[model samples]
Target: MVEADASWRDESLGARVRVALWLRDEVGEGGVFSKASMREAIKGTEQVDRRMRDLRPAGWAILTYRDKPSLQPDQLYLEKIGLPVWRAEHRAAGLRQISAKTRRYVYERDGHMCRRCGISAAEQYADEPGTHARLTLGHVNPHISGGGANAEDLITECARCNETVKHLTGVQMTKEQVWDRMKELPVQGKRQLLAWVKTDFRPLSPAEKVWGMYRQLPAAVREGLEDDLEALMRS
Candidate 1:
């Protein structure tokens, strides 16, 4: 039995714990609730829905409209609760630990850029000017039973793409919208994109690979390199 003091009202609890408690206390099993209501109840909890979704890996059966056609778009059904993450023993449940060696190897292998969107570390999104892309490791095949921490099993991805792909929600652009942009590409560009699509991987050009390395240099060194490159070009 859960303790009486394990209340969702306690602001001190981690957001994940509070979300679990809120579902346990407020919305019992087989209950349906809206994202808005949960967000309202758990004010100040950043990405409350994401915290709730995090429970899924722990065997929490949270059914979204995509999973259950009968549910309204904004509604979610708690089919069953899995682990009691609030408990000390199960606190780290469902979280995978990647070794430092594996992390470094994967990032370097992928050219320190997100394999999904081809965005490098600290590069801002074209659509969202002020927001910079953050890189993270994601499973190459997320639907598989066990997503191991091996280098082959992992791929560098921007944080936005990581969440979106894991959730099976397509990127913000519609297929038609993307196709329209693709149609505008020159013939050579189209051929290059087609090759990338066929392989499901974008091969960085020599210049792009060098640019990724350049982006990692210190500010002073980078400025000096810029001047050297310009002088060499003029010679």
Candidate 2:
């Protein structure tokens, strides 16, 4: 028998453990057990319901289902946490597995703004209540374009802009295209543009990254060398 944690006992852990063990023993390998069977085996409806909730929080039980009894299609089948290797395989595939620290670093690097529209994370929340902040890291070149999951290839963007650019066809645009677009904006628009650009402008290669960094030089520097910057790009 697996040892039950003492702290877990307060949260219907004993009932949950009984349910887990009962399912493990009676249910064949990879076989599905109905909720009704579990309730009967445990001998109480309320106890089974309470124990099922508790088991979920402890990660010991997973609710799966099969469509055998065609008439009553709503019944769920219970399975052990580790019964199917496919469960583990599917989980591994589904999990992005990015660490919290890495996520924070990406956010900090992007200055908490959307790469495409320059919307700050705070603005995104204010504009769309009940939504999370808009600091998502996205790939510069998609995986289809041979981009790997690396810091150099990732940049921050708001969810909307990220989704919009994700469907673009043909060759990926260069950072120069980004800068040229910025030049077309009015003062207020430019300010908003710069804010997002600063946050979401990481390039996929060291050379491109360097170019992007220089492209975002302070407004004062750009003002003094605006003509020169344009001329340099052209030549």
Candidate 3:
């Protein structure tokens, strides 16, 4: 157990604060730690793992197995520390709670798809076809000095794009590769593609809107509707 005066030992502190303290004092930078051990020390803290992740926005670099290949599934490595949230002034740092209204507005504005990749909620990626993308809200100008929590400041994104942008990852495709595909488009298709590039968003057609909504229906219902549509077309 941590000493009584330790910030991590104080039950009165917020779970996020205590988790940060635990990592700083117990784990240290570039140290390996296990979730089970951290949980045992924090005691009764709901979603301790989430609390640790919450520290990231404040500059913490806690790495899970997903981020580091050498680590065991249950192990995490503390790469870097950010804010000292134990101090009162830094307590709410990087913890911007977007309003429910703002979240809905951003998602609705972006047509419920990732603005970066054009993948709708729960849609599979073209490269990793088996894995479905999870949608989330990302800041339109995340790296800006004064980004805010408003509709204009946010955009809908797949969680993958959000992480990639934050990390400034490599491009998904090369220019030549993409240019070849562009050249393959027919004249009308080229015109349509140029419009999307100019606006930087793909507007869904009315039929596409219906198709997206219809995809959420149960298999039985979808099959029944397909039959109805086929019959109607036959008539």
Best by TM-score: 1
lDDT of 1 by residue, 1-235 (tens): 3354599998888888889999988998999999899999999978897788678778888877767889998898999988888887777676667999999898878888888788887777999999887788988875443357799899998889887776663356788999999999999999998998999778777888777667656668889999999999999
Local distance difference test scores for all models: 0.82, 0.52, 0.79
What's the lDDT for residue 58 in model 2?
Answer: 35
> What tens-digit string does per-residue lDDT give for candidate 2 at 1-235?
2342233222344555555556556673456656677777776436575454334333344443222343244454444453221222322221133567776677556555555555655343556676654456777753233234466667777766564454344434677996798789999999875775687433344544444344445557657676887889999
TM-score of 2: 0.33
Give candidate 2 regions above 4 Å deviation: 1-95, 124-133, 145-148, 170-235
TM-score of 3: 0.68
Task: TM-score each candidate.
Answer: 0.68, 0.33, 0.68
Error of 3 at 109 (Å): 1.2
lDDT of each residue in 55-132, candidate 3, tens digit only? 877878777666788999889889999878777777887776799999877877777778887777767789997888
Each candidate: RMSD to true structure?
4.6, 15.5, 5.0
Give candidate 1's whole-model lDDT.
0.82
